[model samples]
Structure formats: C-alpha cells, structure tokens
Target: MFTKEKEFFSILFEAVSEGVIVVNTQQNIVATNQSAENMFGYNKKELETAPLIQLIPKNYHHNHHTYVNGFMKKNESRQMGVGRDLFGIKKNGDIFPVEVGLNPFTVRGETFVMALVVDITLRKQHQDQIQELNAKLEQKVIERTKELSEAVNKLKEVNAELDDENKKRLKAENKAKEALKKEKELNELKTKFLSLVSHEFKTPLSGILTSAMLLSKYKLEEQQQRRDKHIKTITDKVHYLNNILNDFLSIEKLERGKIQYNPSQFKISKVVNEVIYNANMMLKDGQIINYPENIDNYSIYQDEKIVELALSNLVYNAIKYSSENTVIDIKIKQNLDSTTFIVEDNGIGIPEKDQKNIFKRYYRAENALLTQGTGIGLNIVKSHLENLKGNIYFNSKENQGTTFWFSLPNKYQTKL
Candidate 1:
C-alpha cells in the first residue's frame, strides 16, 4: 500500500505543469519530476547529483547561492519568486526565463528544498515584442507632435510677415498722398506767380502798342518811315504781350477774390455788341462776326463790367483761335428764367482729354500750345460767371471747332 501511495504521489508530481526539483540541504538535486527533466532537456538519471546552480543562468547563479545560504542560516521557509529575475539552463546550456517557487520540507531529520519552476520564455518574448511595439508607437507620436509644432510656428511666421507688409504698404500710400498734396499746392503757387507777373506788365505794354501803331500811319520822311515800321513791329509784339498779360491779370484777380461785382439792370444786347466790337480788333484777317439781330432789345440783370469782361474774353478767344475768314456766330436767347449767350467759332477745337481741364487755371491743351495764350482765359470767364451766380459750358471736337454757352438767372434782377 505504501509503494502504491508513493507511485501515486510521483505520478501527481509529474502531472503538474510546474517542474518539480527536490534538493538536499547541501544544495544538490536529489529527485526531480518528469516535468523538470523535460524543462531542462535532461533525462531522469542525468538529473541525479546535479547542483541547482547547474540549471540556473551563470549570471544569476552566484546571487542565488547567497540567497540559499541565507535561507539555510535562518532555517526558515523562504520564497524565491519575489524580487528576482529567474532563469534556467537547458541541457544544451541555453539559458531561458523561468519563475521559481521554493518550499522547504524536513524528512527523517534532513532538510530539503523543493523548487517549483515554470518556463516563462514564451511569456517574456511576447512581453518584449509588446514593449518594442509600444516604443515604436511612442516614437511616431513624438515625431508627429514635432511636425505639428513646426507647422504652427511656420504659420505664425507667415502671419507676422503679412502684417509687416501691410504696414509698409499703408506707410507708402500715406507718403504718396502727402506728395500729391504738396504738388497741388506748388501748382497753385505757380499759377498765382504767373498771374501777378502778367498783371504788372500789361498796362505799359498796351500804351506802347497803341502809340507805335498810331505813329506807323503818319506821313513821314524815308528815315522816319523806316522807324515807324520798326515801331509798328514792336506794336504788334506789344499787343500780343498785352493780351497775354490781360488774361493773366483777370485770372489773378478772380483767384485772389479781388474782383467786385456791381449788379444792375442792363441791355444784354449792348454788352454783346460791345464785346463783338472789341474782339474784332484782334480777329485774324478776313474773320467775320455774325450776331443774332433779335438780341438788340433783350435786357438782363447782372454786373455789367463783369459780364462784359467775361463775354470779351470768350469772344477774343474765339477769334484768336479760328481760321482766317471763318465766321463766328454770337447768339442771345432769353427765357423767363434765364438768358443764354452762345459764342460759336470755327477754331481748332480742344482735344477730348484736355477739354475737362480747360477752365482750370493755367491749363493749356497740347494742340493749343502754338497759339499764343497765357492759359488763363477760360478760368477768368469761369470765375466771372460763378460770381454772377451763372454757369458756363462748352462743346468741342478736334479740328471741328468749339462753342461756349453761359446762362444767368433772371431772378438775380430782384435779388440785386
């Protein structure tokens, strides 16, 4: 019965998943189960007289000996699984991972240690592979985070650059605006200076021209006749200079707010006739003036001097620019609300691009450059019209000629 019980216990030990190794107090292996033999790749007979260290990895064997000695000194049951990296050696001397449980037993007054070991190689291998995969995943996360940070930094840099560019552009635009304003002021000053110079020179020039022209017609000796002819040439030059000066002076007075208006009831036709007579003196040879006969009886209320000056400027400009022998038409149309004066001439018309600026002080068209002018005639006319609470407009085409029309409100008669 005891032999049968022994055989049953041995079979049970061999059936266990753990490898069972029994060692005496001297640390030599005395018995081992079939599982132990298989775990270490040893036969049952070969395990006899083997030291426990023989199955341990060489690096761990020394520390294991110290632990076993401590256990023997204490004479207490001590566990081996805690705080250790367990290892076992195969019959071929290959070391692998293991888990060990040690238990002590006293049999017949002799102490023995029973070590239950489990092969943990496959579990450890799976754990290592999992760790490697986790490490790779962590590395990828770090790389992605770095890339995102770089992209955000780049966007911030670009935004800062754009803001700087916008500020620069705004500064440039402000500078350009300031420059344009300065240019405009300079232009106004130039116009004022030219006007002043022309005014100061006109009166003496007109006197010299009139005197020379009168002297030219006198009966004189041969030497005197030659002198008279020279004087006449000077007269012509002075007359031309006087006209330019007059235009400038008129523009200056208008721009300087020095022109005064004395409004009164007057015959509009008389003013028109007087302007036509004055303009005839400057007309080119063979130029004719045509006036509307019906205007003789029309009356208007306005500043007579200012209106006459305005009409004279327009009529003179028309005759000066028209072709010789071309007929200029002057017409008057009176309505219940206003009076319209139309001056039409067969003159070289203003270019389309220059027409808008024609009334601007000192602005001259490209085609009108050869025509002697101070570039102030239309500006004077515009100023006079504006002062009278009237307005002027014109139409022209290149080479086709021009017509100017202005209207004064009849209500001014009561207002004045």
Candidate 2:
C-alpha cells in the first residue's frame, strides 16, 4: 500500500516543473524529485538523510531553524523567506539565489514539509546589473567639482560622451526590463484570454453542444432540415473556435521568436480581397466595406498574409466598434517610395488618453472596456507591420471616428 501510494503520487509530484523537496520534522531531506535534484546538483540518494540546512546558506541557518521551529509549533505553513532574500547552496558549494515556497503536511502521524524552489539567478543578476549601471550614472554627476562656467564649457564633450554611454547602458537595461515587461504582459494576456474564451468561445461552444444534443431528438424527414440547420451552426462555430486558436497560436509563435518574415511579391488587391472575403462572414446587418478603386490593378512586393491580417483586424475593429449601417472605408495609395493603406470608420473613436497604449497587448480603452475583444489585435497588427518595415498611426476623436493608416516600403523583393 505504501509503495502503491508513492507510485500514484510520483506522477503528480514529478509532473510539477518546479523543484520539490520533502523534509521531515527534524529538517532532514527525505525525498526530492528530479527537478530538485537537478536544480541543486544533487541526486536523490545524496539528498536523502542530508540536513536541510546544508542546502541553505550558512549565515541563514540560525534564523532558518528558528523560523522552522516556529512554523512547526504553529502547526501551519507560511511562505518561507518572506520579506527578505534567500540563497541556496548547490552541491559544489557554490551559492546561488532561489525563491522558496514552503507547505507543511502530515502523513501517518508524522509531519513533513514540502519546499518548492525556483532558481532565480538570472533575475538576481539582471537586477544587480541594472542597479550597478544606475549607481555609476549617478556617481558621474555627483563627482563633478569644478566651477559651473568652466565645468560647463570643458565638460560638455565629456558629458555628451557620458550621455551616449548612459544611453547604451539604458538600452542594455531595457532588454532586461523588456523581459520583465513581457512577463507581465503574458500574465495579463492569460487573464484577457481566459475572459475572452469564457465569454466568446463559450457562447459558440454552447451553441455547438446544444445543437448537437438537439439534433438527436429529430427522427422524421421533416425534421431533417432543422437538423441540417443545427449542423451548419455547429460547423460555423467550430470554424470560429479554430480562428480563436489561431490567434493564440500566433501569440505563442511571436513570444517564441518563431514568426519569420516570408515576404513575396503579391498584388495589393489580392490581400484586400482575401481580407474582405473572409471578414464578410462577421459583418453586422447593413454594415458595408467600401473597397478602394484601382486597387486590383496595383502590385506590391510584400508579405500578403501579413497585410491581410492587419487589414482584417482593422476592418473587424471598425465593424465591432461601429453601429449597424456604418461603412468601413479601405483606401490603398502608392507614393514615390512607399505604399500606404488606410482603414477609416465612423465608429466610437478611442479616447485621447488611451491612444498611447493602444498597441500594448491586452490593453483596452475605458470606452471599450465592455466590448467583445481580446485587446491583442492591434498589438499583433503593429508588431507584424513593424517586422515588415512598416509604420502605423491613427487619428481619432472620441465621438467622431478613427482613421488608421499604415505604410510599407515600396521595394521589389522576392521571397526570403
């Protein structure tokens, strides 16, 4: 029974990607999964029967023991190393940073604690480097002691060099900041995705489920047509679900740096036609897409798929935000060195304050808070256009309308 129980739980325990270590009431490491073993550079055999303190830094041992005893006496579990930093010692005696979460459990009248450990060395290093850079920049200004007139004249060049250095340092720091910012964006994306899926997908999936269930009750020939209607609804809802999944998949590809530009020569009209064709299914009653004239004869050398995506998103946004019977205008124009696409709509324009964050992933304006959207469409559009060496901007008035315009370089290039 003991072996069976262990085997049953081993799957779940190992399934956790983070390192997990189990320690007895005496703080002796009793068992550890592969992640824990690998993280600390210690095997299961080596970890078993070893004092837990061996894994922690020597300087923290006293406080660690006191905290453990207090936790034991309380018979409750709380987060370990809260309000302060924590360090872990690897098998090779090299100390590294870690974040630990502790939970206490009892089995067979004996109490044991489980620790979930995450190695945060990279996070710590980035933090330290940013701090060091900031400190150096501050020290440079504080150490200047010459008179103001002479210093301003003589040190102007040095200050300019320092300014350049500061910019380089800031650029490097922004990389780290981008990582953290992306993490926050992803977390917020999950929330928005869940909300969207719950509200948007649920309705369609519920329709599919309901239609499938209702179809079984029909047996006569007269009911066959009704059953066919339900089947069509199911099929269309399934297709909608596929599109939702595709959007999420695109986000995953973007995050993983797997989206490569595969630009090819294609006619601009082809992109607009495909976008409008696919988007026609989603149009509201009396809604119309006004296609620009003379577009079909135009040619451009760019990624047709990307242009289709951006145009589709903008058109959909126009439709979703505008009331029934509104016209969405699409205009394509070519200048001396670039081709521009404009999507204009008489919809509820974005608020001025929200314009700055319109391209931020999962950011929705106050006026659009209750609107049915994932808030990732513009972000994806902007990202794709930027990758294709294009620029996007918009002009909007709160009650009037919005005109989104973007231009791509007019370069003849074959597929990469």
Candidate 3:
C-alpha cells in the first residue's frame, strides 16, 4: 500500500504543468517532476541530487544561497522574488524569466523546500513592449507641447514690443489707449486659441492612448480585427494631429510673411484627381465623390501647391461637415480672364449671423461649435488666395447648405 501511494504521488506531481523542484537543506535538488526536468533541459538522472545553483544563473548563485538559508530558518511557506524580477537557467546555459513559489516541508527530521516554478518569458516581453510604447507616446506629447508653448512665448514677446511702441507715442494718447485695448483683446483671443488647441489635441491623444492600451490586450490570431481597429484609430488620430500642426505652421508663416509662392503650369485635372482620391479615403458610408465632368483637357498656369492646398481644404471641409450619402459638387468655370472653382455641399450650413466673420481667423459658426476644426483652414485659404490676387466668397443658409467659390486669374502675371 505504501508503494502504491508513492506511485500515485509521483503521477500527480508529474501531471502538474508548472515545473516542480524539491531541494534539501544542503541545497541539493533531491527530487523533481517531469515538467521541471523538461523545463530546465535536463533528465531525471542528471537533475536529482544536483546542486540547486546549477539551475540558477552564475550571477544569482550567491543571493540564491542566502535566500535559501533564510527560508530554511523561517521554515514557512511563501512566494519568492517578491517586488522584483526573478530568472532561471537551463542546462544549456540559457536564461529566462520565471515565477517561483516556495513551500517548506519535512520528512524524517530533514527540512526541504518544494518550489513551484513557471516560465514567464512571454509575459515579460509583453510588459516591456507596453513600457516602451508608453515612453514613446509621452516623449511625443512633451515635444508637441513644448513647440506650442514656445509659439505662445514668442507672441508674448511681440506684444511686449508693441506695448513699448505704444508708450513712446505719448502725443497720440487716444490712439495709444485704443491700441492697448486692442492688445488686451488680442491676448484674450490667444487664450481662447490655446484652450481650443488643448481640447483638440487632448481628445485625440486620449483616444490614441486608450487604443494603444487596448491593442496590447489582443494577442490572439482571432483578435486581428480588434487590433486592426485600434491601429486605424491611432493612424487617424496621428493624421488629425499632423494636420493641426500644419495649420499652426501655416498661421505662423502667414503672420511672418514667410510664404514664397512659386508658380508653374499644371493640368487642373491632375490636381482635382489627386484631391478626390484623398477625399475618397475619408468619405462616410454610402458617400461618393462626383468627379468634375470632362476636366482632363483643362490646364492652369498657377502655383500648383497653393491651388492644391486650397482645393483640398475646401473639399475636405465639405466632406467633414456633410452627412452620409450626400454629394459634394465641384464645379469649374473658365471665363475670359479668370477661372472659378465652386465647392457646394448639402450639409450643415453656416448660420446667417456667422457669415460676416466666416473668413476671420479662429472664428467658428455657432452650429459648427461641436465639429472638430481649428477654424483656421478657411482663413489660411482666404489669405493665400488674396495674396495671389484671387477672391473667395460663399453663400449659405442655416440647416440648408453652403456654396463656396474662388476665382483666380487664368494666366497669373508676375508684377514687375
């Protein structure tokens, strides 16, 4: 009966998936399960009665001995490697992460420890990957915030210079006071812009962070769809943030008179096709871009980049503010000396009260308050067109639709 019982215990020990190792007071591994043998790349004959240090890395031998001695003295059951990383070594001299639980026992007045060991290499890798991702995201946020803060500080310095100039013009007291008032108003507007920037950046960043965290949790092959979803979210948010930064850069350049327009001859069809192709990606469900009819023959002599930017901004805005299944019409008309491009959308239209300030920097219609926009795209477009001797105008009614058209000289003549 005793032999049968011993066999049953051996069978049960071998059945455990986790590696089990039994070490005697002398720190020799007196017994181990099949799992333990396989885990450490050893056989029963080689592992039994072997020094426990053989299964541990050379650097950890001293600490392992000390820990073994302390545990023997306490003679209690507890987990090992608490609050720290633990590792194990294989017979082939390969090191790997591990989790170990120790239980003290005695047979015939001889104390021993039975350690339940688990290989945690995969878990460790996942944890390290998450930490790296988090660090990268934090660094990106820090850099972007620093850039915006520097811009604000530069504005402040400019305002200070203006204040000094106003003070020196004492004879124009009324004008000086008016200038200070305008400065105060401008500062308030800056404050509002900062707040808007924070909100716009924070919302997408939070989404990105959340998606990243969720993406790490899905590791199975069947979870590919979920992973793809989070990846797309990250991609889209990054793109949006990039566009916002571009808008900020454009604003800075326009203010500093740094933009240099280079005109060239290009087919208008090429620009229109490119814009439509990009817009197709951002289209809502059931939405379609109706291509302008017979525009392959049309060509223009203008700054291709500027024209592309303006057209892309208008088309993207039309897609953004419009509903699913709605059509955005791009109508082109060439006249005697000028060509006009019209973007008409049957979406949420601008309020009548907001029409006058539609092209003003940082102004948004009341109905568009909920939309994701910096309200600077139109302003930038308007500035670019006006600088090139072009004009932009729009017609809209609340809840109906908006039609925006801009005219450029057919053959732009460089002022000599």
Best of the candidates, TM-score: 3
- TM, every model: 0.49, 0.54, 0.57
Model 3 misplaced stretches (Cα beyond 4 Å): 1-174, 413-416
Instruction: Give me the runs in candidate 1 sitting further than 4 Å from their true place.
Output: 1-182, 185-220, 223-229, 232-246, 411-416
Estimate the lDDT of model 3. 0.89
Positional deviation of residue 204's Cα in model 1 after best superposition, in angstroms: 12
Q: Residues 155-242, candidate 3, lDDT per residue (tens digit)?
A: 9999998988877766488787899999998997798799889989999999999999999999999999999999999999999999
Model 1 pairs in collision: none
Scanning candidate 3 in windows of ten residues, the lowest lDDT window is 1-10
Model 2: CA > 4 A from native: 1-186, 412-416
Higher-ranked by lDDT: 1 or 2: 2
Model 1 weakest 10-residue run by lDDT? 196-205
On lDDT, the candidate that comes out on top is: 3
Q: Is candidate 1 or candidate 3 better by lDDT?
A: 3
Per residue, candidate 1 scores C-alpha lDDT tens digits across 150-233 of: 999999999999999999999999999999998997888687656645653554566676766667576557568667666866
User: How high is the lDDT of residue 44 in model 1?
Assistant: 77
